[model samples]
Target chain A: MTDSGFKKLVLSHFWVAFGAFGVASVLGLYQVVERSGLIPALQSPKVYFASVSTHGVLMAYVLTTFFVMGFGYLVAVSSLKTPLWNPKLAWVGFGVSAFGTALAAIPLLTGRGSVLYTFYPPLQASALLYIGAALLVIGSWFWCVIMLVMYGQWKKGHPGETVPLPMFANTANAILWLWTSAGVALEVVFQLIPWSLGLMDTVDVGLARTLFAWTLHPIVYFWLIPAYIALYSFVPQAAGGKLFSHELGRVAFIMLLILSLPIGFHHLYMDPQQGKGFKLAHGVGTFLVALPTLITGFTISASLEKAGRQAGGTGLFGWIGTLPWRDPMVLAAILAFGMLIAGGFGGIVNASYAMNAMIHNTAWVPGHFHLIFAGTTVILYMAIAYYVWPSLTGRTLVSRTLPVIQLWTWFIGMTILTTPWHILGLLGQPRRISSVVYNSVLTLAWTPYELAMIVGGAILLGSALLFLYILWKSQTAGAPEANAEIRYAGYEEPETPVPVLLNDFKLWNRIILALMLVNFGYPIAQFFFTKTFGSIGWGY
Target chain B: MSNLIPVHPLEKRWIYVVLGVIALFLGAIFYTALVHQVHPPGAIETIDSATLHLGGEFAEDKLGVRTDADGHLRATLVAARYGFYPREIRVPEGLPITFRIASADVLHGMHVPMTNLDTMVVPGYVSTVTTTFPKPGEYPMLCNEYCGMGHDHMWSKVIVVSRESWKAAAPQTGR
Candidate 1:
């Protein structure tokens, strides 16, 4: 396929992804206002829940999956300097995923699949929802196969050479997704689908949860790796700096692949079926995963510092101010870092075995996730969209100032949104409630925070709409023959003679499989090994 | 394919510092659990939810303060659709109270709003969390998990009174 052909393919994928994101953003704002109990007409539990469920599925599943697939295609073609191995298969995947999204969205919008995007059964939804979800996952698996095949083709053609960093990370994520998604896939195939279809009278909810837990946490990394790829590959170059260490970047990717897969039991820490021993094991592994993030933070900061120094900065932190913040990519990185610091601290507390008592299932959990997902991950997605729009559409962004303002507004809005969410959680306000107008002293204390969240949600909604406008404007605006090309950050040093394992995922994939066996082997097997009761589906 | 610049010394040094901090955080988390006796909720416990209310420890009348053979106060509570069984649990202040809770139907999280005691009560197993109330006061306990439509109304009370008052309130044989 020609470059324009490739661009058209990826652009179509992103348009679908961002379209879902736009609808979800509006639904999210409606939820915040409804939950605040500030408006009477908007406060229906049925409507609120349907909106929440749709918003969650659209943002969490549709947006992230489609964006990653589209971005992966771009990365594979650009980094490998070749067309997609099978462009036809890619379009098929996109069509299947988009159709599946529509199938699931029907139930969610109609209040039929109001199980809150979590298949924590007995609270079951329509069979179509499960089948639709399964199809979405299955569609993405096609992307995985394509990514691996293209990666393999590249390595075979160019023997004894380093895989480009962006392609390597992209492939690692593909491998991670393949492994990480299996748990949920197994759950859907065995339990949820059968139960939802009424083929099974009762389903083992414990097994369902255990399997879902396997997919739940690592999937965050699935959403996050693209952001990390942009950080490592794009941000440094955008800032006029080289990566501090290419070797460290590879190590971080490896660590994420290995550690992110097996430590999902942290999500099940408070779960009763699992033993304390397993939870502690997963908790330790969860903490270990933090190391790679810390490494990323350090490496990225050092890279930025190097950039600032080259631009005549002095002193310890003064280099921060000297770096080019005008560039949308650079500004997004700085903003993402700020949110990461705050969100990472929340995550540490959530991961702490003892400290989890303070915040588990509270509003704090959502607060932390939104900051990480929306604040950190989506900001980078926004930046990447901006960075590549010119190449994809052969059109210049309508206004340079719009993107910078939108980024700042997103950052500001997220801070306003999550800060009080953390406080409300600490104040013992439970999450997943449609309204909090109980008229108690404790409920009264939550009112101010609820109002604050409404303000934040409004700002976020406005920012999201503005973002879509910019992207739309960019596509429709007149072409500029700027001939913008994909530019990845280069390493400061020639990488040390690296082993073949570091270059490719073949050995690493096997190692991850082994680690999963160790981490979850008995935990999952014990369910079948022992006598476990089944619970019938309850909610519609 | 071209030769890049050499690795920066300071960047290498900072990587070590970040790694070290991560190690320290891990150690600190484990130390509290292993040494300080600050255990995670449901440290290790399970119960059959099918028979939860029919018979066994969490049966209706047996849902309040029950003293073990060794004189440790154990509170057995069951969380269900819209409420916690034994809507009121009386515990003596200034002593460690062990709360063993289970979910009868779906997933329910138990949390004492004012205390450092919170845990999810999942069906098929019991969750045990141990903590002490330093002062005598009534602390509201609520279900943190979204069990169903009635999840918002799932609230209970943990009434912590003086030792003599708790003893007086308890049924003599049950204790």
Candidate 2:
């Protein structure tokens, strides 16, 4: 592919993603106001649930999936220094996923699929929602196939050579997605679709929840891997420092891939349908996942430390100031991790089987997710967008200042919104209620917190609009003469022969499988020996 | 600040001060988490003995209030999906009583608001919560958890009347 040719493909995926993002943001703002219960006129439970379901699907599935797929394609093409193996197939994936999105929207927007966004049993939405979601996953699987093929092709072309860091990281993520999605994919295909369609006599709710949990935890990794890649490979370079360690990067990615899969049980902590042995197994596995996060925290911090030192920072943590905060990529990385600490810590608590009781099904659930996904992951995606816009369009950025403003606002809004949400959860505020109208002391306690959330929501709404304006202006305005593709830290990968095991995944996959066998082998099996759980029919 | 090793060109001392400020901020959150106590919601007082008796709505309708300081008595009435029966509860101020509590129809949390105390009250289970009415005002008990329609309307006023009157009424009400 020509230089601009690859960019156009990437940009197309981005355009689709941003289109979805822009739409989702508007829906999101409505949801915030709609759920707040301050305006009685806007507080129809039907409309509120519909808006929430659509908003979640649009943001969590649509925006993340498309952006990650697009990022994967571009990163593979550019970083691998190779052509996209099947461009037509990639577009086909896009077409199918987009079509699936439209189909899903028909049901979600009509207040039909208001069973909430989760795959809980007895609470059923329309059959179309389940089917459309399945199609979307299938479409994503098509992208997964293309990613793996591109990866294998690259390996074949350059035997014994290390894959470019970006491609390697991207491939690891693709592999993780395949392994992780199997559980949910099976659930959707076998359990949900059939039940929703009325073909199945009854569905086992416990089994469905357990399987979805398998997909749920690892899926966070799928959304997050791109952000991590941007952190490991792009941020240091953007900050004008060489990557601190290629070897450590490999370990972190591999650890993430393996750790992400086995720890799927954390989501089942509060679920009664799953047994204690299984929950304990998953809970222990949850702590194992924390290792990779710690590794990541140290590695990324050290990398930033390096970047700071290179920019002439001295003393421990003093160099943190020397690092460029103005560069959108660098700023995004910085902000991303700052949110990660708050979000990640909440995740650890959620994973702690003992503490799960504290926040189960509470507002704390959304609070943690919003901080992680919206605060950290989405910002980096936006950072990538900001960086890529000029290169793809042959124009300079419309306003460098606006990107930073948007990032800062998103961070601030999330902190304002979610901190209180966590507190509200602790205060016995159940999620999904429009109002705590009972006027008891407990409900009385929630009023101040709810008021704070409204302010946070307003700030975030304005910030999202500012983001659209920046992206839109970049597309149409800016100096048409400024399009220079940048390279990694201006340093060629040091010419060296690395061991095959260190450099590639020949043995890693086997190691992962074996570890997974040891890890999840019995936990999954215990489901059968235990008393057969009674089936709960589809609920609406 | 003393370990601020000189390293790079254009490195400013002012930057170090800013970093120090941030370090201090993060340090404080750690300090708070380490030193602070996290009080989760739960049953603060437990009644293992048969001192406090909890029964269902049928039992509650025939319930009598024990006396307290100032001769006042009180009780908490819970609201559920079905129409409220035994909606009024009698409680004695300063007098501990076993509240035999049960919902007439769906499950509910038999919550005492001020004490941050509650227990799940299932219909057949006859879940009871017991506490002394330390002070007397018209303490309104409401169904906070969702049961169904009339959830909002499910509430009863606890009148902590004088012990003399409660004694006179208790015999008549029990009879």
Candidate 3:
């Protein structure tokens, strides 16, 4: 089923993603160690901010975009049982993205682009960084086009047929990305780029933040939908059971797409540009988005329960022990869910309009996101890589036990790293600082948590290296495994023909546009109408 | 739709529970916001950040705690790349203190440890957060957002004295 060209394409994207991940992990360790204030020789705020910026861009933008693109390609090809639409164009997109990454890396390494990933202006970075970022997103737009085109073509060929569930979710992600990226895209092209290039003397900081808030929340769903895909489509089969409910999976994906977009103002709750009415509106939308996640938790748990019972488990709690624990995918799912629960609790706090003031911009923000992004999302990316590596490379994984061990270490390392981070946040330690120079009793109490973070970061670094080694060894030297074909989980019951509203996205797109207009229309337009001031660019 | 894809009875019940949980959270948020008047800092006041230091409420002498004509307490502060203006402020406990902070350059954040006095001071906007300090003590006011290379060093001190002592001390200068 694997075409050599398509195989090479997927592997290339994955390599870029993991290569960026490996470098970011090293930088992550350096940051924790430097910020700990124990290593006198390593405490340079100049270097620390630069490293933090690069680490953020690499992890948040580079790794996520590349991995999601590669995974989407694999799912489209394998699940749809079709050749990639315009293979040449796909390679072109990859080249553009890779070149953009290289261009961005130059400024990032030189300390000229240390504006951090959020890059809130008038704190400016090099214009090249914004341009490179714009190019990277432009390249990804090509993937969105490819995914949508293939989706349309498949529907045309098989009228009224239910699309493969993985592809269904993947296409939803593509549409979501198209909408999500537009916010940052507008900001970068019109505001940041011009201001950084000296074409504009000053930028409306409120408008810039408003546009970014448009991208801030929904972009999370873009990274997370792929993880959900793995959970719904792959984890069940890997756990030796069928999916509990196929319709519910579709419902969750659509709900995530619509509910996630209008709620981004929750990020701007603390800002003065928007009014309380709009903030409360967005706050409500934020909680509404949590429904899909809860549904996902319930559906996946039920699927596993059924699987466990099917394997000769009798008692109420015996089903848990009966499931496959050694399987990398199964273990990764369990770990991912455990972290999601923890991360979700923190997310609820962030969403609460008033409670947000307690933790906004503190270390708690980073702790919550790292658990969700690095812990839950990226861990599942690793599991998906392990699951499909055999099919993609035509080789067996180098060591079975190494992956199991790797997943466990990643989970344990994240728990260690984020737990103390939350505590430090509560103790009123700010994030994105090089050291605690206050020298007060309150500052003294933060030293222990800083040290704990170092240990957690070291463990995570080691685990990341192990993961890359497994992938490299498997691709290069391991023997080929015969009959390495890809298969998604089957349904518990035969899949009935889904309604057009559930199967198609036309209605959802309309709802999203209407929601965006209602939620963001006045908030953004008021910036143009009111007497607002713009600030000139400033450099660190 | 139901005939096309009937949901599992257990899953249907779960959906109701999910809605109930969401309602509870929203209810709590609305109750506090409407009844108690506890809301996020959202004052939509604008200022020219570049020239903020020249002459304004955030000028050098005009900063720090002040008493208004209505006998209300207010604090005006300036945030820049490195530190907060005045670097230290003394206020009375058990009184509602309105903090009107503006950034001179770039974006900054201010938070007093163990209090709800937290906000982002965007360059072009004034972040106004009002709250009462119940406990009288010295608290560290830390810059929680990354402003520049000197971000870690960007902090100040807040001395919360008793209301009686605040009256005995020199009267605040600015109106």
Candidate 4:
């Protein structure tokens, strides 16, 4: 009850995050409808591309960065049972990020920054957008430093004690992010900002893409680890059971941080910039990262099963029926896992060295990511928000039924949307097109799928609005909840001693440094050694 | 501090299953890449995208299917803002045709649907991929990556004709 300052801090960050989400959802609906070519009045390539760019920036950059920062703060304070490392500094980071978002919106809304979120050069957007994006990332670095410092402080104070699992996972994400954002940050500061500002005449597109690929794959992991944190830290306790194995959770976090960094070349599988050996090497790493997710899946499922059985469930499958589906966190986890299974399958195809050609840059790419990032990751974000709203706001939820409905609708809507998207990819439909103006037989096959996506988008838009409404109502009008204290899942068995290696990141960081040097050192250095011709900026 | 907890027995077995699944995938990928010579396009050839059309291999006159010195067919193409150069090209079916494509402006991705011939034509790099078209048909080759405003219209055709007819029509160019 005395943590009002922390509550205010968390709520401020979440508001910015969800505000971006709300606007992006509206843009997403427009994009699906317009791209369907159903409404003649809505068909404009300029607007469509601009909307797509804005939507991507909002969801991928704004929403994820803010949400993770806010959530990390919450985990740091609540799990460590300590005051925020630097409250004023945290507010400054939020201010810088919010200001950057507003600055970027200037160009994005005016159709000047239509270069999609990838912003692959030599296609250029307004320099303001790049600078804004750079600022946004810089601000997140502040959050990262804060998280790491708090983590180090906690460990120093409680020598040889296992860092609380939530803080452990949260700190791992902070390290992962600092590593992940470095690639794009270098590209932005060194290449994009100068090139877009006309300070540099030409930029090496290959290097740009290589750097982006470095960031692209791991950024997903960055967004995902917090969701994983929610699953590991909250789901079991919320389900009225204990964590199945705390050690496995720590191992999963460690694996994610190490394996996710050097595997980005899988995104460049079909690009001509890198070599086959490097691509194959990165592809292997991509597959290695999946192991942790599989571990997590097993661990979380077992935990849920234990919870279900404890609630008087019997037999093999009966435990599933006994699970408290009405609990928002439990429902979200189940839905998220289901989506992860489907999305992970698509990802495997993408990471396959030769198999990537079948669907690279096709609609399938978006389909897979939407299923993973938006479907699985964001759904869990929603669940975490719902579970913590009472503690954060010191009020009861306005409507529990609305949140349950919202989660189901999100899952259903995502399934409806991405199913056709995958079908279209198989049909050879390229992604990022404004309209189906090809009028060919292959494109004709995509019409029904496009139509299906519009319906999906509308449903998702409704769900997003409902989510924001629920949060708004809970914050403003809901009755007070006096006993709202955050609780994390506990281990089923008595605590076992944790190894120094698992508890600390020093060895892992060193391993990551070596792996990154091996994976990227030559590939990136090759660009400088070769007689590369940089290309001048071209506007959309 | 105590020692690290041993992984649960059931979880250890599950971990093995996970590793097996990953190994199976890696096996398939390695086999296709090594034995079948099937791999993603990773041609590290660079060109000045700004002046690509002025002369040399991607010059307008040199853009299309042609017989190389090795007697293998190679298609040289250029992807610009709105369309692929040559708009349409005829290649014989059931023959391995290597495509060496580059972007004259911005970045683009080329994919012939239902085939494994897909590569991103980065502005300053040549994207090369080789594949055989078994069935004769007019396949639409579309730009999978967004280039600019005219991106939706950025598509061409790959007309795969019967080998005999293609040879008869252009015997001098045909192997």
Best prediction by DockQ: 4
Count clashing residue pairs per candidate. 1, 16, 0, 0
How well does each candidate reproduce the native contacts, as fnat?
A: 0.48, 0.01, 0.86, 0.95
State each model's CA lDDT, in order.
0.85, 0.67, 0.92, 0.92
Give one digit per residue, the lDDT tens place, for model 2 in A103-158: 88888888777655565554566788888888888888888998889889878888
Residue A66 miss distance in model 4 (angstroms)? 0.4
CAPRI-style class, candidate 2: incorrect
Off by over 4 Å in 1: A437-440, A495-497, B1-8, B42-48, B167-175
The C-alpha interface RMSD of every prediction is 2.7, 10.7, 1.0, 0.8
What's the TM-score of every candidate structure?
0.96, 0.77, 0.99, 0.99
Model 3's DockQ score: 0.84
Lowest summed lDDT over 10 consecutive residues: which window, candidate 3 chain B? B1-10
Give the poorly placed runs of model 2, Cα more than 4 Å off: A1-5, A489-495, A515-539, B1-175
- Residue lDDT tens for model 1, B1-175: 1123233566567666877887898889878878897767544455667788688888887877777888887888888887887777677898887888887788788887667888877777778878889888767787787777666678877778997786677453332
Q: DockQ of candidate 1?
A: 0.48
> What is the Cα-based lDDT of residue A325 in candidate 2?
92
Q: Give the candidates in order of lDDT, highest first.
A: 3, 4, 1, 2
Residue-wise C-alpha lDDT for candidate 3, range B1-175, written one tens digit per residue: 3566788899889999999999999999999999999899876999988887799788887998888989889999998767888788889999999999999888899999899999988988999999899999999888988888889989988989998998898897753
lDDT preference between candidates 1 and 4, better one: 4
lDDT of 1 at A271: 74
Among incorrect, acceptable, medium and high, the docking class of model 1 is acceptable
lDDT by residue for model 4 (A257-291), tens: 99999999998999998999999999999999999
**Rank order by TM-score, top first?**
3, 4, 1, 2
